[model samples]
Target: MTTAEAETGDTLTEALTEVLSGARARGGLFHRAVLAPPWAVRVQDGAPLSLACMLRGDGWVLHPAAPQPVRIAPGDVVVLCGPTPYVLADDPATEPGLLIQPGDCCTTPDGTDMCEKLALGVRTWGRDADDPTVLLSGNYQLYGDLSTRLLDTLPPVLVLREGEWDAAVLPLVATEVVKDAPGQQLVLDRLLDLLLVSVLRAWFARPQAQPPAWYRAQSDPVVGVALRLLHEHPGHGWTVASLAAEAGVSRAGLARRFTGLVGEPPMTYLARRRIDLAARLLREPDATLASVARRVGYADGFALSTAFKRLRGMSPAAYRAEHGAR
Candidate 1:
């Protein structure tokens, strides 16, 4: 086998890590559940991603299209990408007793509120306190448009079995979720991000995994260095010739190889990266539109606003307002 084929696995892993980092968790929902037998909760399709871990006892995750529900044992982590509803229950035969809607709202099937009724303690909720089953669940609410590349690559359901990955941060997240102190939410958000990266790292390492084209293209010697440079310095004014020179290849060779491997020309990819970075910066209160524009390679706020509105369907100020940023 050639050098490119040999290093494909390592390059794909690095590319996935880079892509996933673009969708950093802002403020998500975390809940600690303690339940007993004969109980089930129907999770609606709203959040972009949902993560559940079996902390104690066992349960089953039922999907509508699956022939059989998946069993979840202790230490098992499951990630569900929506909008597809699923059920978590003690057994596959159990009917859903409660419904979970967007914004973490809970209710009965008949539309009666259940959030306050099932509250156990800080960040804790379930049918019973001394229940046999315990679970740690998190929901990622806000993901930028750039995350579509990574999210589209994932399956509807992914399960990482116990001992398959290192989850040292799980315990820390479980502990911090119940804290009512200041900055506790921030702590949980960071921990959830770590958990997600760790799980994906393990999943992509499986031999049978079929990574995306861009991920696979990172193995090429020329494409790999160019990708790194583009990702590391999105604000730099990069042209085809400049990128080719930096990667030690002629302009024509680099353009052909990069387009063939990555499915897009180098300049197009760079533009997308700059827009992604600008979106993230717009969420900061101190970062003005002009400042964000300059930092992301645009000439001024007007140039950035035009592109942002064209690509994101909103101006920078409108985007910030929608996201509740100052």
Candidate 2:
């Protein structure tokens, strides 16, 4: 390795070792706060999502899961996730009920709800939304929509106690999110991206293991090129020979390098990726299984079924019924 490569690898290794050590903790590697009014929002199931953090105004609430009512006031941030219904309000009893759109409120069981006003804030996995308005005066709920594989590597929620560091960064992001300025979405997205890196840094600083093999390859020129090609062209008939040629390495060398870094040879990775593509296609109500299989490079529906079952623990039809978009 060159001096720069060696230094980069060592630095990455050390950083990963530090961050992953706290992998089992309650803290998340990504977080954000919202100051917008209560608005309506609904997320479809199987959306592959997460909430890293939420801030109201000044104080902060960490891990907003509770058996009873919890007070969320101005400047208090609460973090939560894992596909459960959570309502942030001034009165816990007044938490909005079913059919209550986002940016609104409902009632609780015993009618002892504590929050009256609502402000939505969130940290998400992707940068689809640039500036999300969180001004508390009007009724609005900040919603973020994005899908990223990186979520698989992070903890569910982490609510930090508001402090100097948070003040310096979070408010700025929240302002950008609410401003809805020109190219503000792009600006906010980039900021969130950097914030995610900061969270990862904090995680590693606390001693974490190396991230998943795919994420790690983001820094590897050789492996990154191969992975990008595979991700971007899953429909293409890719082979070890073709990929090696594209990577400018011998088949044996490419295979060795790929396996060393990705923990699997190129072909095995491709098969899994193909199956993943098939699974996604099958989830579409209009996509036929036969077409999905053919598109992913399987010869026929039966062959696709057999391979899908082996890799995904379910037949394609069953998987579609369970996960398909309704």
Query: What TM-score should be assigned to candidate 2?
Result: 0.46
lDDT of 1 at 30: 92
Estimate TM-scores for all models. Answer: 0.84, 0.46
Taken over the whole model, the C-alpha lDDT of each candidate is 0.83, 0.50
Which predicted model would earn the best lDDT?
Answer: 1
Per-residue lDDT for 75-119 in model 2, tens only?
A: 433334444444443334442322222223322344432233322
How many collisions per candidate? 0, 51
Which segments of model 2 are wrong by more than 4 Å?
1-151, 155-211
lDDT, candidate 1, 1-326, per-residue tens: 77756666655666777777865776778999998888899999488888999999999998775677999998899988877899999999999998998878898999898889999999899878898899999988876622666686687888889888776667888888889999887787777888888888888878887776677777678988898788778788889999999999999999999999888899877877777778888878788989998899999999999988877788888888877553
Error of 2 at 215 (Å): 2.8
